[model samples]
Target chain A: MKRILIGALFALPALTAMAGDFTASLSIAPEWRTDNRDSAYFVAPPVVPVQHRSARQDLGLRFRDGGFNAQGTLRVLAREGQTPEQHGIVNQFYYDGDLGNGSGYTFGRKVISWGVGFGFRPLDVIQREDRRSLNPPPLTGVPLAAWEHFSADKAFTLVWTHPGHRHEATDFRDQSLAARYYRLVDGNDIHAVARLSGRHALEAGAGITHTSGEEWAFHAAALYQQRYSKTFNTLAESGGGILAAANPMQEVMRRNGLKAVLGSQWTGTSGFGVLVEAWYDAEGYSRNEWRRLDALTARQRSLNGMAPASAINGNVAWSSRAFERPNLLRENLLLRLSHDDERWKPALELLVTPRDGGRVITTRLEYQSDRQRVSFGLRFLGGAADSAYAQAPIKRMAYFEWRLALL
Target chain B: MFKNALALFASLLATLIALPALAADDIAALLKRADGYRLLEESVRIETLVESYRGDTLDKERRYTVYIKPGRRSLVLMKSPAEAGQKVLMLGDQFWLLMPDTQRPLRITATQKLLGDASTGDIANMTWSDDYDGKVVDEVDIKGRRCLHLDLSAARPGVTYARIGLYLDKASKLPIKADLYVHSGKRAKEAWYEAKTVDGQLRVMSMTLLDDIQAGRRTVVRYQSIVALAAPDEFFNPAALVRNTLAGW
Candidate 1:
C-alpha cells in the first residue's frame, strides 16, 4: 500500500502535464497536550505514559480528469520522545460514470456523507464522523459502490459499503447496504436514510433543514437503531470488587437505540454568527452508569495503604478508558459563536453535558490568503470539580497548523 | 356640439391618467435591454475571475464557473485552489453550500450568502429584470455620456441588495453604474460595468466594485467567457449537487 501511494504521488505531475485539474498542498501542524496531575487516575509511577507534544507534516495532492478523481497524502510524524515516522494515506480514489437520464454510478473509494446539523448528524450512518474532535485530519473515504438517480429537486442513492467484507469488530468496518432519499420542497430540505447490516440489523433516520427570513436556519435529525453496543466495566456494573488484575471492561449489546439532534443558527450581515445545538445518544453512558463507575473508582482509591499502588493504578486506568468515548454522557449541548471577516475567521465553542455539569471550551482562529492558510486553537476540559472532563487524565490541548497550496 | 366636447375632454383626461402606466412599461423594456448586455440568453455558462485589490495592488484572486438557468436557478463552482470542489446551488430564494471536505450540502440564509468578498450572488446573478422593478428617475450626463438613472427596489425577497440606483446609457440602454443598498438602506458598494464587443456583440465583460464600508478595498469581477448553455435541471438540485461531476459541461 505504501509503495502504491508513493507511485501515485510521483505520477501526479505527469497527470497534470497531460490535460487534467491538479492541486497540491503542504501543511505542518504541531499539537501540545497538558495532563491533569490531580486526577485520582494519575499515579506516581504512571499507569499509562502520556506524550506532551507531537508534530506532523503532510504533502497532499488531488487530481480530477474526466470521471476519474484521486486524492492522497504523504505524512511525516514526530513525537516528543519518539522517532519520526513516515506514511501515506489514500484519501480517495474513485471513478464516476454517468448513465443516461440523470443517473450515475461510482466505483472504488469515495467519501459519501449525508446528514443535517453541525454538531451531531444522526443521519450520518455511513461516515459516523466525530464532530467534536480537536485538530482533526482530512477524512479517508470508505470503499464502496453506489448508484444514484436525480431529478430537478429530488435524488435517490443506494450504496454498498465495504464490499466483499464480512462483519467487523467496529461499526465503520461492517458490511452494510445503505440508501438515501432527498427532496427539496417549498424551501425546505428533507432527507431520509436506511441501512441494513449484520451487527446492527437495521438503522433508519430522517432529517430536515429550513430557513426563515434572511438570517436564521433550523435543522433537526433523528436515527433509530434496532440494536446498539456499549462497553462498560464489569466491576462497576456488578457492584462488587474494588480492584481487578485484568481489564474488566467488556462490550454489551442492547436493543432499540436512538440518536437525535436539534440545532439552529443565526448570522448577521456584519459577519457574526451563533449556533446552538443539543443532541442525545442512546449509546452513550447514562447518569446512573457514570455514578456507578465513579463510586467504583472512589472505593478503589480508599484502599491506598492496604493495596499496592500498581494494582490500584491499573484498575483506575482501565476505568478511565470510559472518557475516550465521543460523548461522555447521553445528552449534550453545543454553542458556537463565530465571526468571518473575509480573510480572518474566529470562533468559540462550548460543549456541555447537562447530566454531570461537565463542559469543554474551545477557541479557534484561522487566517486565509490566496495560497496559504494558518489556523490555531486552544481547548480546555473543565467545569464542576466532579465532572468527567475535570476528572479526566488530560486537561488542556493546543495546536497550530499552517498550510500552503503548491499547485 | 356640447356633448362632443365633453366626450373629447374625458378622452384627454384618461390618456393623461394612463401616462404613468405607459412609462412603467418603458422602464421595464429598458431594464430588459440593459439585462441583455449582461446575459445574452436565458441560460448560460460563465467562466469568471475575481480579483480583490487594496490600493491598486492585487491582494487575492479566485476563479469560478457559474451556470445560470431560467426561473432564478444558478450554480457556482469554485475553481480556485483554496476553494476547489466547493459548490453553491441557488434555487429561487433558497441556497445550499457544499464544501469539499464535508461532502454535505448545508443550507445558508440570504445574509450568510453575502459573507464573501465576491458574494455568490455577485458571480451567479447576471440579470436584474427578474429581481428588481422600478421607474426611470432622471436623465443625466456621467463622464460626458448621456445616461438614464433608474430607482429600483427589490421585487424578490432573496435579492442580495434591497434597493439599487442604476444608470444606463440613454441610447444603447446598457448598464453603466449601480449603487447597491443593503436591507438597512445603507449604501454597501458602488459598481461600475465595463462592456466589450465579443463575437460581434457588445457584452458587459467586467465589473469593478468599490467598497463603501471599508475604504481602500476594491473587487473586480471579470468574465473570461460566456456561452449559451442550458445545464440539465438535475444539476440545480441541492441534493444532486454532490452527485453531479459536470466533467464535460
Candidate 2:
C-alpha cells in the first residue's frame, strides 16, 4: 500500500507538466450619468434633472495549447436607479479544437450567421419594454424589471479554409467550408447556416440561412467579390427574407416579404474614400404592422392619446480621413449627414395625427490608441412628429455625447 | 629532428581543434550583424480577407501612409472614406489619437495591447534592449536549414515574455523562427517568418504565429508592400497625438 501511494505521488509531476498556457485580466468601469430626459418612453418630456451611477466589472481567462483552447469571460453590472437597485451577470465560454488539415470544431455562445447584407444580428439576448396607456411616463427610471431574464443560446460552428489559411503558401491554394448550428434553451428557436468560399484570384460564394421557431424565417444570399487593382476592389450581394410561420397579423397586413441591399467602397487615394449603400424593403405594410402592434401592446398610453401606426425611413452617410497624423497612433476625423421620414396614424381613440419627416446631421471625431479608444460627437435632429402622451407636438433637439475607456 | 617533428604535430592538432571554435564565433558574429538594423522606418499598405468559420468571407482593405521610427515614434494616416480624418501617433512612452471632426486628442495606456503580431513582443519598447541579454547557444538545423540558435533571458522584471529562443538563418543572417515564453516560466508561443527580398533589402513578407499549446489555431500576417519613410521630428511628439491631422491618420 505504501509503494502504491508513492507511485501515485510520482504521477503528479507528469500531470502538472501537461498543464499549458494561461492568461487572465480583470477590468472595472464605474460611470456617472446625468440625463435631461426621464426615460426612454418619454418623448421630449420636460427635461428632468436626475443623477445616476453604475459600475460594470468584466473578467476574462484564456488557456491555450496545440490541440485545444478554452476561454471564458464574466461580466457584472450593478446600478443604483431611481426605482430600485439592479444587478446582472453574464457569462460566456468557448472551446475549439483542430480537426486537422484546414478544419476545426468550436462550441460556445458565439455569433452565428442569420442576416442580410451588413445587418446580420446575432441571437443571444432579447429585451422587452413595458408601456402604459395615456400620457407617456417620464423618460427616467428603470423601463422594465419583469422582462429581464437570461436566455441560453448556444451554437456550434465548423470552419474549414484553404486559401485563407494563415500560411501564405496554403492560402495560394483554394478549398474551404463552414457550417453553423444554433438553438435556444426554450427549444423555441433553431438556426442553421452553411457557407463554402475560396480565392482563385476571382472570388465568389453562396450561403443559406434557415430559422425555425415560434416565428419561422428563411434567408438565402449570394456574394461575389473581386479585386480589380492594387488599390481597387468591389463586392456585391443579394438576398431575400421569408416568413414561414402562419400569423394572424401577417395575414391581416400581408406583411411577409423581402429586403435587399447593395453597397460599395473605394480606397484609391491616400486620405479620402467613399462608401455608398442603397436598400429597398418590398413589404411596406410590415412597418405599419409593427407600429400598430407597439401601440396596442403599450401598457401605458400617453395623455394626448396618439400612437404611431406606420413609418418608413431611408438614410445616407459619408466619411473621410482627410486630416491625419503619422506615428504609432491611428486617428481619423469623420463627418456624416443623413435624412429620415415617418408617417404616423393615431390609434382610433386619439386626437391629433400627422406625418413626420426630417433631416439629421451628425458629426463625430474618434481616436484609437492601441487597444484604448474614445469618441465624441454632436447630433442635430430636425423633424415634425406626432406626440403620444403630450398634447403638444414633438420638436427638434440637439445634444453632444462622449464615450471613454478607463483601461 | 624528432623533437621538431613532435612540436609540428602538436601545432597541427591545436589548429584542428580551434577550427570549429572559429566557425562558431563567425556564425555568432553573423547573427549580431543581422540584428544591427535596430530601427526601421517604413509605410505599409494592407488588405485583409477574413474568412469566418461559417464559410462567409469579408474583404476589408486599407492603406496607411505610416512612419515607424524605432523606439521613438510611430504614426498612421488614413486616406479613404472622405467624411472625417483620423490619425494615431505614438511618441516615446505616451500614445494619442486625433479626430478631425471633434479635433480632440486622447491619452492612451501602455497596457492596452492590440490583437496582432506586433503585440506579441516589446518590439516597440526601447526597454527590450535591456530585457534579455542574448547569446549564441549552439548551431542546429531546422527543417534541414542550418541555423544559429540563440537563447535570451530577462535582465529585469516586466519584460513581457520570460524567455526567447531564436533560430536565425545562416545564409541570410535573418531571424527565421522564434519561440517566445511568457508569464514567467510558462510554455512558449512560436512564430515563423517567410522572408523575401524587396528593393535590395531582406524583409519579412509574411509571418505565421502558432500557440505552442493550442494545436490548430494560428494567425498569419502578410506584408503587401513597404516603403521607406522620412518623418518629421514632430510626428513623434506626444502633444501631436491628438491633433486632427495626426489623430485621423
Candidate 3:
C-alpha cells in the first residue's frame, strides 16, 4: 500500500502543473431491451429481465498539456426500479516522455491492446472481459509502466502490469511482464510477443496482418498458453477437485495448448467491407468432458432447493457456460460486414459453432455526426437446448442508445 | 543498293537516339518546375473535405487534416464522420494508425484508405520526384494551350499507384491532370487539379477524382487554410500524435 501510494504520488507533480488544462465531457444513454426467460431463475444480472429499462450516464475529465496527461471516467447507472449506483474508473492516465534515441515511456494506469484477433482476441490475456453484448463494454486500465522504441521498420515494446498495486502474496517479480517485437515486411506488420505471468505460466504469441493491394487483406494470430492457469471455463469438468466421480489432477494442466485465429478482409469500391474468420481453441473441453460437466450441473440444480449453500459450493464449477471459454464450443466461424459510407452505417456480426450449430447474430444501424451518435441493435441467440448459446438466459434482445457529447 | 540502305539506317538510328535524350532533358525540366508548385518542405494545417457522388446521389462526405513534413514524417487526424479521434503517423516506411478507442497503434500500409478516393499516401506523400521515374511521352494542345504528357513509374513497391500518367501545362508547368494505374495495368482513377494563385504563386486549391471501376462515382477534395510552417521533431513522434495535446496543435 505504501509503494502504491508513492507510485500514485509520482503523477501528482505532473498533474498539478496541468490542473487548469482540463476538459470535461458528459453523455447519457438510456436503453430499453427485451428478452424471453423465466423470471424465477434469473437471480442476478449476468442477464437482465425479459423486459428491462436502464439509463447510463458517463462523465469524463481529461488533462493534457505540456508533458503530462490523464483521463478519468465516472459512470452513473440506474435501473427502472432499482437504486442507482455510481462507479469510477480510470480509462488511461499516463505521463509520456521521450528518452531520445528512439525510446519513450509511459507510466500510469492504461489499457493495452494486444492486436491478436479481430473480434475475439484470446491472447488478450491481461483482461478478463465482460461479455454481455457483441461490442462489449470497455475494460478498465491497470496500473503499470510501459516503454517502447522505434527504429526504421522495427519497434519494441516492454510492459509491466500490476506494478505497485498489491496487498499480499506477490513481490515485484510476481507481476506480469510482457515484451513485443514488431517488424514491417512488404508493408505488412509481423509481431511476436512473450509474456511471463505470475498467475498464468509462460505465454508466447505471434500475429501477422497484410493488405494485398487495395481490395484484399489477410491476418493470422496464435498463442500458446497453459490450461486452467487462472482461466475459468465453467462448462469444462474441473480437473482439480477430489470427488468420487472426479479425477485428481494438477492445478495447471500438463497439456499446454494453442488458440489461433485466421481471417481475411475484403473491401469493395462501393464502400462495403466483409470479414470472414475461423477461431480454434485447443484447450476447449472435448465432448466427453462437456457431458460430464453437464451431468454435474444437472445434479447441482436438482440439489439446489434440497442442499445447503455449503454443499452447492462444494461443486467444482457451476454456472452458465455462456461466458465460458472463448466460444464455449470448440470450433467457431465468424462473418462480419460493415459499411463505411456516412448515411446510416450498418454493421453485422455472426458467430457460428459448426459442430454444435449454435449461432449468435448481432446487427446494428448507427448514425454518427461530429458530436453525437445514435444506434439501434438486436442480438439473437439460437441453438439447441443443450448447445452452447441456448444455455444463456436470454433468447433475444433489442436495444437503442443515444449519446450526445456535452463539453 | 547496300550503300543506300546503310545511309538510311544510320539516319534513322541517329533520330531515334536523339529523341530519347531530348525527352529526358525535357522531362527533368518539367519535373523541376512542377516541383515548385507543390512538394514543399513545410507543414500545412488544412482541412481536406471530400464529397463523393454516385450518379446523382451524394454517396459519402467527410473531412480530415493531414500533417505533412515532406521526407521527414507524416501524420493524419480524422476530424469528422465515423472514425473521429483516430490519427495515423508515418516515419520513413513505418506507419501506425491509432484508432479512437483502442490502445495500440495499428500498423497500416501507406496505400490504406483514409476517406473515399483519398488514400493515406495521397495526403501524406509530398514529393514525387524521389519515388518516381518519368519521361515525357507526347505533346498535346487543349483549349488553345500546349500541354506536356508524361508517364511515371514507381521505383518501389507498396506505393499508392504503380504507374501514373501526368499532364502539365507547358507555359506555367502547372500540373493539369493525372491518371493512377493499378498493378493490373487498368486505369483505376483519374484526378484533375484546380490551381489558384496564393501569395503570388500557383497552388493547388482542389482535386477532383473519379473512380474508373465505378463510373459516375467521383470524389472532390477541397483544401482550406493551407499555410507553410515547420514542424519540430517531436511533432512527428507517435507518442505526441496520440497525445493530441496542444503541443501538436
Candidate 4:
C-alpha cells in the first residue's frame, strides 16, 4: 500500500517531534463462520468462498520517540457478499540506534518476537508467529537489520531478517539470518535460535523458561528445519488418480524438519489459570500422509453417479486445502483455562489431534477498561468420526471486539 | 548434681541468644525508620500516578516509570495509553513482563505480581528494610495516632504481600497504616499513608489502596516524581527488558 504510506509518513515526524510516547486505538472486529455441510470436504458451491460474515475497522497507531518507533494500522474492510475495503498497515517502523556501552541497533519494520511456547513456538526463528490465529491482526513487521547486546543476565540478538528479501516461499517471507541467545541461569529463562533461510535452509532452536513456586510455569521448545514445505494432493501423492482438471495442490519438499513444544502453567492468586501444551510438527500431516489423503478422499467419494459431478466437486475442493494447515496433525494438544477478573477476562481452549482424533474448541471473553476494550469469541470443530476435525470444512467460529483508546 | 544441671543449661542458652539479638536490633532499627518514609535514595526514579476510585466515581488512570536499584532491583515503565509498551522487571523474587507487541520476556509468578491499578507490587516496592522481618507487635491507639504495630513476615517468597500489618508513626517513625496480607491470610488491602514536604524532604507522597476484597475499589497511589536515579545495570536485565528505552533517563 504505497509501502504502507511511506511507513506512515516516516512516522509523522515522530508524532510532532518529541514529547514521545503516543498511542491511539479504535477497533471493531466482527467475524462469524459456520459452513460444514456434512464434510468429505463439502462442496455444493465452495471451491473457496467462505466469508460468511466479516467486519473490521481498526485504526491503531503508536509512536515512541527517543530512538523513534512507530506502529500503524487503518483497515476498514467488510464482507459477507463482499465490497467494502480500505487499507494501510505498516505495523512497525523502528529505529532504535544507540551504540554506547551495552550496544543497540534496530532499523525499520520491527516486531521481532523471539518465541517460547504458548501454543507452539518452536523457537520462532524470526517472527513466525501464528500461535493459533483467530481474531488476529496487527503484527506485520519483518524487514530487519538488528544488533543488540546486553548483559547482567545476558542477551544478544542479531537479525537480518527479510532485509533485501527474495527467495520467499514462506518461512514468513524468507530471506533470513537471525540469531538470539539469552540467558538468566539459575532462575532459568534461557533461549537460543538461529536461522539462515533460502526458505528454511538452516534453522535451529532451543528454549526454556521455568518458574516453580508462586504458581508454576514451565516451557520448552525445539526446532530443526533444514528444509520444510507441504502442499500435496497431486492425486494424493501419485497413488493413482481419480479426478483433476484444475487445482491439484502440490508444493512438496522435505528433509529433516521438526518442531516441538511442551508447556505447563498454573497461575492462581485467585485469578485462576492453567495451561498444558504439547506439540510436534514436522510440517504437519502424516498419519501416513493422512491415510493417503483419506484414501484419496474415499476414492473421490466413490465416483458418485459415475464421475462428472464437476469431477467430484473439483476433487473434493482440491482436498480442502489440507485443512488450511497450521498443524492439521502431526501430534498436537493444548488445553487452557483462564480467568483474570478485574474488568473480567476469561478463556478456555482445547485442541488435540493425537494422530486422527482431531478437535479444536475455543472460547474467550474480555472486558478491560480505562478507555474501553470488549471481546468475545467462540470456536469449535470436532473430533473423531474419522478426525481431521471431523472431516472439516469449517464448523462454527464467532468473534466480536470493541477496543477504544483513541490516544 | 551434674554441676547444677550444667549451670542451668548454660543460662538457658544465654537467654536464648540474648533475647532475639535484642529484638533483632529493635526490628532492624524500626525497619530503618520505616525505610525513611518510602525511600529517599538507594537509587530511585519513581513518577507513578495510578488512581482507580469507583465510589465517588473516577474509575481508572495509570502511568508509571519506577526504576529503583540497589540489590532488589525494579523497573516498571508502562505509561498508560492503556499501558503503552508495557514492562515490569523486578529481580528479587524474579518477575518479568514486557508486553506491548511482545519482544518476549514473560516469566511472571509471585501471583503475577498483582498487576494494574498500582500493583507492580504497588509500583515497584518502595522499601521495607529489604522485604520485611517482624517484631514490634503492638502499642496501638490508631485514631489518636500513637500506633506502632509491625507484625510483618515474608522474608521473601516472591513477596507481594504475605502478611504485613505495619502501622508505625509512634511519634514520627512515619508509615501510618497498612494491612495488605494475602496467601490466604486474607485482609487484602487497606493501606493509607500520605505525607508531604517534598523538595525539603518528609516524602511518602500518597498511597491509599483499600479494596479488602473488592468493596467499592479505591486505589490512589501518586508520587509524581522521585529522582535520584541509578538506572543502568543493564536495565535490570530480563534480557534487557526488550532493549532498554529508558528514554531520558
Candidate 5:
C-alpha cells in the first residue's frame, strides 16, 4: 500500500503537465413534494401509515481543474407527520491526472473499471446511502446490511482505448479499449467497435469483460462479464449472513453476467425518428455448498439464491420535428413505451416553441402501474445567434419530478 | 434595324441569367486571398454586450484582455475584479480554464460543445479563407456607398455558420457589413463593423450583431486597444481553460 501510494504521488506531476484546461459552475434548486405512503417496503400487515408533505432545497457546486474535479451537494428535507425529519450532505470528489504518456491516475470516489474489459461495481458501491433514517427499515438482515454502509475498498480503474477511437473511450470515463471500424457496403456507411475489459480484485481474484457492437441507424451490442472472488469471514460478516456456517464448504461465487442488446435509432431527412431497444441480462451466483444449503431449507433461502436469474427489457421511443422552423422556434414530440418483466412504463412528452428564437414549453406524462408522474415546464432557450465575442447563457426548464420505486 | 435590336436584347437576357453561375467560381478564388493572412499574434481588449428583446431589461456585458499567438495559442487575463490570478489559456487544440479558488487548470476536450450548437472546433482550424468560400456576386450601392457584395458558402460542413455574404466598401476594400447565414435557407445574422486607423493600420474598432432569429436581439463588441505581448507556448494549453483569472471578464 505504501509503495502504491508513493508511486501514485510520484506520477502526479507528470500527469498534471499533460492535462490541460478546466471549467466549473454552481446551481441551487428548491423543490416540494407530497406523499401518502410511509415506506418503500411491503408487509402483510399495516404497521404505521403516514401522510406527509415535504419541501427540500439543495445547493450543488461543481469544479473541475486540470485532472481534478469535485462536486459538493447539500440537501435539506423538511417533512411533516409521523415520519422523521431528514437532512444530509452528499459530497463527491474525483481527480484523474495523467501518469505519463498514456497512463493516468485517479483519486476520490469514482466509477471503477474491472478486468481487461469488464467492469464490476460491487452491490455495496451501488447502494451507498448517506442518510438512512429517511428510508423505512428493511425486513431482512440482508437488505438491512446492504442498506447501511458504503464500499470498503475505494475502487481503482485503469483503462486503455485504441488511439483512433479515443473519443468514444472518454464517454465511459475513459475505461474502454475499443477500435472503431468503418466500411461502405452498397453505398451505406457501416461502423463497428470491439472492446475488452478486465477487473482485478484486491484479494487475488479477477474477471473478464468483452463487448462488441456494430452501429448505423441500427445498433447491436453484446456484453459478457464474469468474475469470482473467494469468500472470507469479513465478507460474510459484511453480508450479514450465516452462509459462512451454513455452507462452510461453499466458496462465495459473485458474478454479473450480461447478454446481448439489440437497439436501433432511425432519424432520416424528415426529422421524425423512432428508437427501439431490447436487452437481456442473466446474472447471479453459484456454489456447490450454497446450492445444497438452499435445497435443504425454504426458510433459509431467498429466490435470488438461485444460480442464475434472467431479466429482459425492451423500450420503444418515437420523436418528430415536424413543426420545426428555420430561425424561430422548433418543436418536437416524443412517446416512449418500456417494459422490464415486472413493470410496464409509458411516457408521452411534447415540446412547443412559439418561434424559432423564443421560449419553449414542455409537458411530460409518465405512468407505471398505479404511479403517475406528470410535469409541465417552461424554459427560455438562449438566443439563436452567436455574438461577436461572448457566448450565450445556459438555459434550463422548470420541472416537477415524482418517482415511486416499488420493491 | 428592329429585327437586329430584338436579337441583341435576347443575348443580353441570357447573359443576365448566367452571370451568377459564372461569378460563383471567382468568388471562391477571392475568398482564398483573405485566407493567406494567417498566423497572427495580437493582444487586444474586447468588450461585449448582449441586449435583451424586452425593453428596459438589463443587458449582459463582459470585458476581456486577450493575447493570441499563432496556432490557436492564447491567454486571456481578466482585469475587472481583484480576484486571484485565474486565466484561460489554449495551447495547440487543447483548452484550459484556471480558477483562483482552486489554483488548478482543467483540461477541456474539443468534443465538448459550447453554447450547445458550436463544437469546440480546433481554434487553429479557422482562417479567413476557410470560413467563407465565395465570389464577387454583384456590385451595388447601399446608402449611396458603393459596395462589393460577395456570396460565400462554407468549404466544409459542420461549421457554426453555413453561408456568409460580405459587403465590402469599394474604396476602403474593407468589410463594412456582413450577413452570416446559419444552416441553409435560414434568415441571416447581420453584423456591421466600424473601422478606424490605428498605428497606420486599418482595424475594426466596434461591431454590432443583429440576430435574425430574434427581431430585436443584438450584441455589440467594442475593441478598446491592442498591444504586443509574448508568452510561453504551453500557456495556451487545454489545461489553461480552467484558469479563472486568465478568463478576461
Candidate 6:
C-alpha cells in the first residue's frame, strides 16, 4: 500500500499544469415506484404498503494533467423513511506515463476492459459490480498495477490487482494477476487472456471482433473458469419443527464451467443502432433449479406472518448478495435499439432468460442540455410466477436522473 | 471526309471509356498527394465549429479542438455548448469516448454518428491513402470549374465506407466533392470540401455534409486556427481525453 501511495505522489508534477482544468458535476434524482421491494422486508405488512420513494444525489469531480489524472464521486442517498447516508468513491486515480521503448504502465485504480461483448462480456472477469441502482453501475475498479507494450500489429499486457476492501484472500501470498495478448489478423481484432486469482481458481478467455463494412459489427467471446460454483445453496438453522431444517447458503459442488457470448450491431444511415446479444453462463442454475427458487419464494410469501418462525422461509430473502440481482438462468438474450445523436437519445432494452422464460423490459429517454443531462426511464419485469425476475419482490418502477457538470 | 470524321469520333469515344483504365498507375499517387495536402504536418491542432440543420430549423451548433498525429492518433475535445467536457480518443483502430461524469472512457464503434452528419469514421480518419484505392474515371467541368471524377474503393476491411466517389480540382488536385456508399452501392452521404491558402499552403477550410438518407438535413464544419504543433503521445491517451486544459478553449 505504501508503494502504491508513493507512486501516486510521483504523478504530480512540478508546475501542476492541469490543476486549472478541474471540473465538477452534481446529479439529483428522485424516484417513485409502484412495487417497493424495501417494503417487502423492512416495513411491516399491513392494510396498505407505504409508497416507495427515494432521493439520490451524486457529485463528481475530475482533474488531469500530462499523464496524471484523478477522478472521484460522492453519493448522498436518502430513503423516504430512513436516515440519509453519504458515501465516497474513487472511480479512477492513475497516471498513464510512457516508460520509453513502447512500454507503459497505469498504476492506480482504473477500469481495464478486455472482452468484446456489449451487454454481457464473458471475458470481462472484473470482480465487483454495484447492483443497487435501476441501471446497475458498471463494474467497480480495483487497485491495480499494469504494464503494456504494443506495436502496430501486435501487443501484450500484464495486470496486477489488490482486493482493496475484500478480506477473502486466504494468505499473505494472495496476489491476483492477468495477462493478455492481442493481434490484428485480416482486419479482425483477436485477443486471448488468462487470469490467476484466489482459491486456486484459474480463468482463460478469447474473443474476436470486426467492423469491416459499415453495415454490421460482429463480436464473440468465450471464457472457461476452473472450480466454479454450481449452486449457492446449503443447510440452515432449524425453526419449522423437523420438516424445514436444511436452509442455508452453501456451495453444493465445484467444477469447471464455461461462459460464452455472441453479439452483433446493425448500423443504419438514419443514425439508429440495433444490437442483439446471446449469452450463456454454465455456472448459473438450470430451469429445474429456478423452479425450486420460485417455489421457495412462494412459500415465503405465503408464510408472511409466520416467516420469522421458519428459517426455511427466511432463506428466500437471504439469497441475494445484493439487490437488483442479475437473472440467474442458463441462457439469456438481449435486444437493444437506440438512436445515436448529439442532444436527445431514446432507447429500449429487452432482456430475456430463455430457459426460464423470465423477461425484463426497459424504456428510456435522455436529453443533453449544455453541461447538464436529464433522463427518465421505466422498467418492467415479468415471467412465470416462479421464474427468477417474477419471483423478485419488485414488479414495476420508474426513475429520473438530472445532472449538471460545472467546470 | 465523312469516313475520316467517323474514325476521329470513334477514337474519342474509346479514350473516354479507356481513360480510367489507363490512369490506374497515377491513382495511388494522386490519392497520396491529396492526403498529404490535407495532413500538411505529421502532427497538428485544429479548431472546428459545427452547425447542423434539419429542414428549416437549426438542430445544434457545437465546437471542438482536435489534436491529430495523422494516421496514428487523434484526440477530439468538446469545446462549447452543452457538452464542453466530453472528449473522444482514437488510437489505431480502437476508439474511446469519455463523458465528463462517466467513470471511464467507453469503447465506441467507428460507424456511429458523431454529430448531425459526421460519423466517427469521418472524424477518426484524417488520411485516405492508407485505406483507399483511387482511380480517375472521367474528366468534366462543373459550373466552369474543371474537375476529375475519381472512383475509390476500400483497400482493406474495417473501413467506414466500401466505395467513394470523389471530384477533385483538376488544376490543384485538391478534393472538391465526395460521395460515400455502402457495400451494395447505396449512397449514404455527400460532402463538399472547401480549401484556402493558409500559411502559403492549401488547406481544407470547411466541409459540408448532406445526408442522403434524410432529405433537408445537413451539417457544416469549418476549421479554424490550424497549426503545426507536436503534441506528446500522452496528450492523445485515454486519460488525457478527460484533461479539460488540453486546448484551454
Best by DockQ: 1
| Model 5: per-residue Cα lDDT over A1-407, one tens digit each | 33433453355445445433322221222232222122111111122222224444333333455555554433444454534333333243555554332234444543221111101111111121211111111111001000001111111222232222323221222223322222223222223333443331111222211111111133344443453333322322344432222223223445644434344443221123344443332322222322222232222224234422110000000000101111111121222222221122222322222222222222333332222223232333333232100111123334344432110
Candidate 5 is graded, for docking, as incorrect
RMSD of each: 4.4, 23.9, 7.9, 21.7, 17.6, 6.7
- Better TM-score candidate (3, 6): 6
TM-score of chain B of 1: 0.90
Per-residue lDDT tens digits of candidate 6, residues A1-407? 33433343354343244554565667788877666353232222232234478877766656766667677766777777667777677887888767755567788877666666766767766542322246443234567888887555566778887745344333223457888777767656687988887643798999888664455778899988875555444422222332244545555435688889898888675568898999887767777665554444445556756556445334554544213335367698989999867568898988898876788888889988667888999988777655676655567878898888655
**TM-score of chain A as modeled in candidate 2:** 0.38
Give the per-residue lDDT of model 3 (tens digit) for A268-310.
6456788899987765554455555556555655676676644
TM-score of each predicted structure versus truth: 0.94, 0.33, 0.76, 0.35, 0.45, 0.78
Compared with the true structure, model 4 gives a TM-score of: 0.35
Q: For candidate 3, write residues B1-249 as lDDT tens digits.
A: 999999999988886785586476756566767766764445665667777777778766677777776564677777663555578787655566787566656655444454445676666665566567788777678557688778999876556678989888977878888898876688988988888888787887788888897788888878775766665555565434454443455
Q: What are the candidates' individual DockQ scores?
A: 0.66, 0.02, 0.19, 0.26, 0.12, 0.25
Pairwise lDDT winner, candidates 1 and 4: 1
Best by lDDT: 1
The number of the candidate with the highest TM-score is 1
List pairs with backbone clashes in candidate 3.
none
Per-residue lDDT of A243-312 in model 1, one digit per residue for the tens? 9989998888889999999999999899999999999999889989988888999999999899997888
- What C-alpha lDDT does candidate 5 achieve relative to the native structure? 0.35
Pairs clashing within candidate 1: none
Candidate 3, residue B131: how far the Cα is off, in Å: 5.5
> What is the DockQ score, from 0 to 1, of model 3?
0.19
Worst 10 residues of 3 chain A by lDDT: A241-250
Winner by DockQ between candidate 6 and candidate 2 = 6
